[model samples]
Target: MKQELLSLILPSRNEAEGLRRLLPELVTLLPDAEIIVVNDGSDDNTLAACTEFPVRVISHPYPKGNGAAVKSGARAANGDVLIFMDADGQHKPEDIPALLEKFKEGYDMVVGARQSGSHAGAHRAVANDVFSRLATWMTGQPVEDLTSGFRVVKANKFRTFLYLLPNGFSYPTTITMSFFRAGFSVAYLPIHTPRRATGKSHIRPTRDGLRFLLIIFKIGTLYSPLKLFLPISLIFFFSGLSYYLFTFVTQHRFTNMSALLLTTSMLVFLIGLISEQITMLIYKDSD
Candidate 1:
């Protein structure tokens, strides 16, 4: 079989120094692959730094956000397979080949799952675990790293979700769930990221952390609304049943609270049933 064209996309903002060292390594390591860098309005010499390199550089007028930069890069990439990695000097260049090899194994997407202790902060680690668990339950597939930026995906498949992709840092979470819900095959490979070698991380855990949770719930609802609704419905239904039994034993009658809880449970289940049907209609042929 003929080899597919590969495109390596790096989204940067104030990563001039890191790009100075990383870009050359990419050029030397993967000479034939197309390398494109999208500068997200870095005030530093990010654009000038790429002038000396042989990479195609595209600069935004102002800061658009990391996810926006990724969409810009994906739109410009002309490869059968596209690989995205951070320009913050976290992802290792050597891991690129492994991701490509996994892609060749008939997987539509391959995510670089970071090992434990790979996070820069303790809270970030806890937050990532929560996202992963939520994603795993929502998709019915084990998601090792739902928020990892280092991933390989088929360009054609990835492009389909561009419109749905958020213009923020939660792009990874959105795409990962979308792929799984669309019935695309996804695999995870253990990868270890080093501490930043340049500027500090742009992510504000307390701020972006809330955004991540919202993105997770948004994608979960978009893909599988029933997965979330059904569990809550069951909780309310059982709680109401237990309460009703207790009231019957104590006062020989069912209380209004039990009736309200039971009614809410039925309403929630009805919503989940309707949502399940809508989800099927929406994603019928999306794959």
Candidate 2:
């Protein structure tokens, strides 16, 4: 395969020590790739560490969010392929070539799927598995990892849906589904990395975890609104129909519950149809 210009975007926030160790190794392996370190209002020596290596550093005056940093890097990147990786040192720079290789095979996006043991804890592992399964069912494709940050994507394609990406930790989830729904090929390559070399993790399960659940629903509604709306509509429609039948057999009259359920079913279905049309229009140019 022919060589492709690659851009490595690292979104950092108070991850000085991690960047200190990671940058040198990355520079050695990816000498030609454009390296960009987005400082999301890091108070630490993150900026200083990045200066040691040949990298472009974009600093946010104040902390925006991880996804915001990604958006910034994506806009500034000048490469055919864009690689997004975590700044906490959990993503191995060596595994990047594998992802690129997958991309070379005509995949629009390639994720570095982490093994079960690679998760920070048991609960995290279980939660990630649930997210993966949910994504798999939603997209009708096997989703090996729903939250892995280590991935390679076609830069133009990745930039097309910038508006849909949230300025938070759930951007990965949003991007993964967007590709699938857009009829783009996605591949996952197994990867392993050691424990973080520096500061603590930024994710708070109770807080960010709740946001993740909402993101799942968002993904459903955004990509395939009917997939989510149709099921609920079916439930209400069936219940209403059954109730009306039972009333006719017993009291010989339709009750308010029957009318309410049927009406709600119709409304939901209509809303879903409208949403689906809007989604199609939004992505029509991409097709």
Candidate 3:
């Protein structure tokens, strides 16, 4: 086979300094594996810097997004297993073995779960906690980290959801939830990350936080719309019922507000039902 058994994908954007330091070490360690550096429209000499290494560079002409870079790397990779890590060196090269080891135990994907204090900032840490809890409830499985980019996945299985991944930083969230909801085995290995080696983080708390919130909403709608819609429908129904009961007892009449509330409740429930069916049909051919 032309492809190696494993491939390493590093998504980079103006990370020449980190890539220069990282590539040589990765070359020494995983000599046989195919190394792909997806240079996501770096204004710096990221492409030029990678020339000394044997790794492949998938260069984009203009800036797309982190997830877009990842998608490019994934499509270009020719391996049975794919390992994804940051090009900025937040993820450790030494942890690669641990991810591979855990994955060999039959997991479709193995994530490098970030330990306490490994988070980039307090706000992101808290946000990740909330996202993890929500994902755990939705999947009925423990979600140690919902946004860890350090992971090794069976290439075939991962490519199945390529279309679902957005062209943004939220790809990690989408893919993780997709695996859980699709009944694929996933494992997490604890790891600590040092501060980034190079390049400034593009993640702004206000902006990316809102984008991730949108990711959560997309996850709800994509995997199981009913999980999101049913609870909301029930809340509206109960509120409407309470309002109707209060008016019936106090005024001996069904108020227009009560009627509107009750109607809205039923409408939401019907929408949830239809969404659930559509979600099922969409994944019917799923492997």
Please give the TM-score that candidate 3 achieves against the real structure.
Answer: 0.96
Off by over 4 Å in 3: 1-4
lDDT of 1 by residue, 1-287 (tens): 88889899999999999999899899998999999999998999998999989999989999999999999999999999999999988999999999888878999999999997674688778878888988888877899988899999999999988987888888998888888888999999999998888988888877776786686667667678888888899999999999999999999998999999999999998998898898777667676
TM-score of each: 0.94, 0.93, 0.96
**Against the unseen true structure, what C-alpha lDDT does each candidate score?**
0.89, 0.89, 0.88
Residue-by-residue lDDT tens digits, candidate 2, 15-39? 9899998999899999999999999
The number of the candidate with the highest TM-score is 3
Q: What is candidate 1's TM-score against the reference?
A: 0.94
lDDT of 1 at 188: 99
Per-residue CA lDDT of model 3 for 149-205, tens digit only, reads: 999999998998899898899899989988877788999999999998888997888
**Candidate 1: where are CA atoms >4 Å away?**
none
The CA lDDT at 254 in model 3 is 91
Tell me which residue pairs clash in candidate 2.
none
